[model samples]
Target chain A: MRISPTDVAQVMTLLHDDPEFRFLILSDLCGVDTGSVMQVVYHLWSDATPDWLRVIVDGLPREDPRAPSVTFLWNGAEWAEREAYDMFGIIFEGNRDLRRIYMPPDYQSFPLRKDFLLADDAARSPGQGVRHMEQTFQPAEYRRTPVLRQGLGSDAGHMAPGIQTAELASGEDPAR
Target chain B: MTTEQTVRSLDDPDLFVETPGTIYDAIPPLPPRTEREAEFYTMRDGEMLINLGPQHPSTHGVLRVVLKIDGERVVDLDPVLGYLHRGVEKICENGDWHHAISNCDPLEYIAAMFSEAMPVMVAEKLLDLGVPRRAEYIRVLAWELNRISSHALFVGWLALDLGGLTPILYGFIERDEIVEMLAALTGQRLLFNYLRIGGVNGDLNHDFLSRLGDWMGNALKRIEDQQKLLNSNEIFVARTRGLGVIDRDLARRTLLSGPVLRATGIPYDVRRAHPYSVYPELEFTIPTREEGDSYARYLLHLDEIKQSIHIIDQVLHRMPDGPVMAKVPRLMRVPPGRAYVSIESPRGQYSAYGMSDGSDQPFRLRIHDPSFFNLQAVGLLMPGNLVADTMAIMASVDPIMGGVDK
Candidate 1:
């Protein structure tokens, strides 16, 4: 079931209170950054349902995503919401203890956001001047040795031996 | 300037101001960032704050708890987490589907089989893959053995934390045997990345079977001996009985599963509640205790060991012969979809939610670790207990910090 951010608290309350759909256990609550939008996903388990019922609070904007907290329904949601906030920067409104759970309190950027590039990913792009070590620095001498060139070789040592030192020095990939 | 004038000038606000310390401060007096922290930091007339651990031995791992106490009794506690956080979810999203399984291995380091299994099962679901019967049986066998080892350590640690030492020695003996058997099967002892997306990595071999058969014959007897040592010990019972009681409603509300929830008499085991991975085909029982105290949780672990042994025996008897590894592409990309898979780990329900965007890598992989949620109960259970009983309560909950901080 997909719910709007505003309807999260109300819909979750209904699921918890209704005898027919008593999803008493909030099996999981997590934030997902799908590149297009931020989503708060809730997994609820109940005897009533054979499998887990997934409720996604979809279409929260990437910037300053806010969703109602379900801590009142199930207190276990507290840490889960904190983790989501810590990783994805989605504020779970009404969670009294809404602080960073896994990240340091002073962490500036949400690590799990789509836009948050990992150090290596941020350092170089596909066609940029910066190249991966394997792409640029295959040793010219190591390639000359036959036994070392074929089987027991590091990733950087596996390039074609025919490529000249000048090509390797210029960081030009003959394979590409 | 003269020495006296230099000292005075250095002390002057205009000349030199005090710099606030960073997080590394021995005792950071920084302002509280949240409501709970502010409440726990504030001291009443007779109350004082005691920092339990980011380093205490009984904390199991690097878990810090700020305890507000009035004399010997704990008024409140705020557990400060993130000491073991490795940004596992983000790392999983950055890697491909296959790498996610191995990356998850360290989440529940104690029982890594379940941690690895979660991602594999979720990826299988997303890919709509069917594992062979022999492979499923192998997976279940590995998981049950891992469960026994985890529970054995839990028994030992709980006893050790409460000041008894003998039971842990016995606990380690039993754990070592099973772990050695697993090492023969999985190639690594602790972080066994055995479960592949479609099936397990290797087939059961002669060495693994012989070791398992040898252990199986004596496993029950060994556990019974350990039980004899601690089950009726006056000191163990005195400390654990009626301590850190979590009622059924609270257990449900807190989403406690496995033995802790079972100890509360709910009997909500993931294997039976939401059956997965050939568990529905297997035979076993969900053990429960109505007392819901620390002792009940302790006894539940012993009872669970017996049940796991039973499951293993059944698996061996029903073991099928076939190729273990399924045919999967070297570079696999799952269809764009979302999948949530939960399994009954020794601690509780270890689950994973995998979202694939028709790419080799997952868009997001959320791991719902049992220890993370189980640790939350510490904050709920600690208040109103004596300061000394903190380790006792925490041990019974058995929250592995790797999982909690992940």
Candidate 2:
């Protein structure tokens, strides 16, 4: 069902009351900026059905962003709300605990916000210790180890260039 | 919202080893919180705080579950992740479109095809490019094989979790074959950076098809053999029969997808309801379970494997001869817009949310990993279960850690 911003409160209540949507799990809440302002998108799913609902609730001042938390419905929303806080600078009212999820707690600007820019010096080597991504800092000269693979009964590609039984290499039976 | 110290015992090590004597090396069971769990029982009369892992073998991938239990039952379960979170989304955000595909390989390493495709499919939608029929077929082929292999791992892992060892060996016996097949075609066994922006990075030759077809022919029998082994084992049935019983109401509310949602008897296959690639034209059945228990969920995978094999048989027969790529502008620029796309992975429904500011790289990209959403569900399934059956239920839910904590 297509819902409006005015109906966000009612929808949140329906998420709790409606047996199908109760538990009110908000799978993802991310900001999508059409141009000037970003539209807040909420992806919700049913605990019973193999289905999900995409709910779009706009929270755009691009400055003083705020949206009511659905944490009351599902406890899982606590962390999701924290991620939203760090990425979009969106304040989740009534959120049980709001801290930066991916970034350090003292971080300033939200990396996911459309206007956020990467620092200058890190341009030449994108893999360098550019701010925000520290623990996963890989240098420019890094080369991934190449993968070697082969199929059974066929020499279409490189097969490690060794003498092993065809079926044994494929992990299948030679009898087959 | 809780990082309770009560989950630990004074004698417990932060990281103690499970399966101490075995080669498998599983994590040891969490020590019972007799004194504190008793207080949690007295205070809430219903609120129970139980731990799921850091040691749990079901998905020993740094997964932990905090459950609010109400006397042999789970009132609410909140999943604790970030243990395996490498900030893959953050990594993807900085890299260009091409660079991102390589990074996507590790998101859900088990079903690397789906993980890799999740972003590529969205990029295609954003770039407004047509995927060559050959590439779509190749994707369908690789994806189905990956689906089967992942399902095999699930079946085997479930067996291992439920105290059965035979099925796992049989399942991996088949997995090694498929991994070899993928390795030959994509040049990488686990991470296939084979899918490029406009088209595939390579072609699907004769040997790949024949090898894949051989596995497809025998995988159905393997599933059949597993069913025989499990169906005959009374212990397997008893432990898994009604343990971790999931109600349809909770299943629908949580938006459970894949086999778990199917195990609850809902036909919400992304391939069926929202058919992508050649799923619409191809023939396959959507497996379902009415009981909504671990056994029904367990039986559902056996059925799903059959369906995947059936789809692969068609993919092999209708192997249309053509180029595996489409022509496109070298420098891609997606016009300002947004598109949310999903694929029914072996685990559940995996989706990607893409936005572009009329640029080559997306202005904002968010990957809604299925395991991330599905892992939250362990809270719902873990309650009312024995400390041992926790892993069994986890296997039934099938949370791939890479996907869960990505």
Candidate 3:
């Protein structure tokens, strides 16, 4: 679901407090870059059932990406949040030890971003300064972006305008 | 001297100051406040920093756990990972959906079946592909076989870590038998890329089934012989019994699962709780021990192996005969959606979270490895124990650095 970055910590706290929706384990917390914006995805799972709830906070400004951290709620989120920050350069507010995980401490750019160029691939060949693959080597249809779907809303799992919630089944404690 | 003259004088050889020895020897030792440290000078301010391994055998893989110790107890601990990081998630994002199955084979190298199955199941979920009944049965059969072998290796390694050599050799015997069976079924021994997106790579044959049946019949006796070798040994019990007792709350807080969590009295098993594949039809118990110690965790491995054998027996009897692979396209494109599919791996609840942007390749592929999370509990388990007990606690956790670093 798409939510404001400001409300992420509060919403996570609310979900954690709810007896009906026991999202006890923070299964995974990761971030993605969608051209114009950065989106942070949080996957929560209840131990009792097969249900998993996904919470997405999208449309964070690309220039200064920041989201509230949930380490205080789930201690396991400590490393996961650091990893998210490491990959996407999205700062997790209030993370005491928010350090780079996979990448080196002095890494200049987030490697996962669409615009970031790999060092090896970015270097020009001996004689060919800047050569682009011609039409003869056009990539497959699936490799190219499909006629741009109705923006990030449709791209991030049919998530409605804001705070959308869906489940595999009903009566299994739907999130508020 | 003037400020400019003073700065320039620092470069003059006459004014230069030199320590008597190398850089490390130049620093003087800190003053000791207690009798424990009064006898000798310590490396840091009252604490010693020890790097356990990036190359030590007991660590099981390339995992470097820095331990800060005061006397014989651990004062602080920090695990340094990424020694084996191959950017697997990023690699999966760039590759086609079908090829990514092979890419994930090394994440949990000890039990490659579970790691390989995760991406396949997630892609299957995203595409809404229904695996054949026979294929599901085959998957469970292979998965159980892999689980038994992985646990066998763990039991042997635990004994080896606690300074006993014979149990590990016996462990190799059991593990070799299971691996030989799996290798015959799936063309590879360690990283079997046998499981594909739609279904498994191939079907079980008569030769494989007969051999597996014979092995399954005597598997319990072999496992028991291994348990008897180490379970009652006075030294083994003394070292591991109450060495690292992680309670239920700490296990939950640390996000521990599988045997470690089961050892703490939680009867949570992803296969039983979530009921993935053909696990719903099969009946087996999720073994739990109230002790929440290394000994309990060790016993849990033995108990769980027996349960896996029971599951294999059920699969063998109710084996269906049909097409193994579903009709998947040459190049598969998953619809724009997000799905998280988890299986009860030998270590814990190993999950694959795939986000597809209606492309042949995934936009992002995040793997929630159980060993990666379970390894975190070492900090809680290692604080009060003696220095020697560190090996026992780490062995009990059974962390595979391939999974942890990935």
User: Where is the poorest 10-residue window by lDDT in model 1 chain B?
Assistant: B1-10
Residue range B1-406, candidate 1, lDDT tens digits: 1222223455567543334344533323334445554444434466666788899999999998878789999998878899988888878887888898899999899999999887799889999998999999999999999999999999999999999898889889988998999999999999999999889999998999999989998899998988889888999999999999999999988878889999999979999999998899999999999999999999999999999999999999999998787889999989999999999999999898988899899888889898988899888998999888999999999999999998
**Candidate ranking (DockQ, best to worst):** 1, 3, 2
Top candidate (TM-score):
1
Q: For candidate 3, what is the lDDT?
A: 0.77
* Candidate 2: tens digits of C-alpha lDDT, residues B1-406: 2222234464666325311221011211211112222212222333446675656666658776665566665655545456777656656666666677888888889888888886688888877788888788888888888888888888888889888888899889888899989988988889888888777889986777678768766777778888898877899988888877767667655556778878888777888766777788898889898998889988898888888888878887887888887877777676777767788888777888877677676666777667765665676577566666677788878877787667
CA lDDT of each candidate?
A: 0.84, 0.68, 0.77
lDDT of 2 by residue, A22-139 (tens): 5344556666654466556877655555455778876466767777777656555655667777677777776645655555333467766645545643675587656433233222
Give the per-residue lDDT digits (tens) of candidate 1, residues A22-89: 98888999999988899999999888876999999999999879999898988888998998998888
Query: Which regions of candidate 1 deviate over 4 angstroms?
Result: A123-176, B1-19, B24-29
lDDT of 1 at B13: 77
Q: Is candidate 1 or candidate 2 better by DockQ?
A: 1
Chain B TM-score of every predicted model: 0.95, 0.85, 0.89
True contacts kept of each: 0.43, 0.05, 0.18
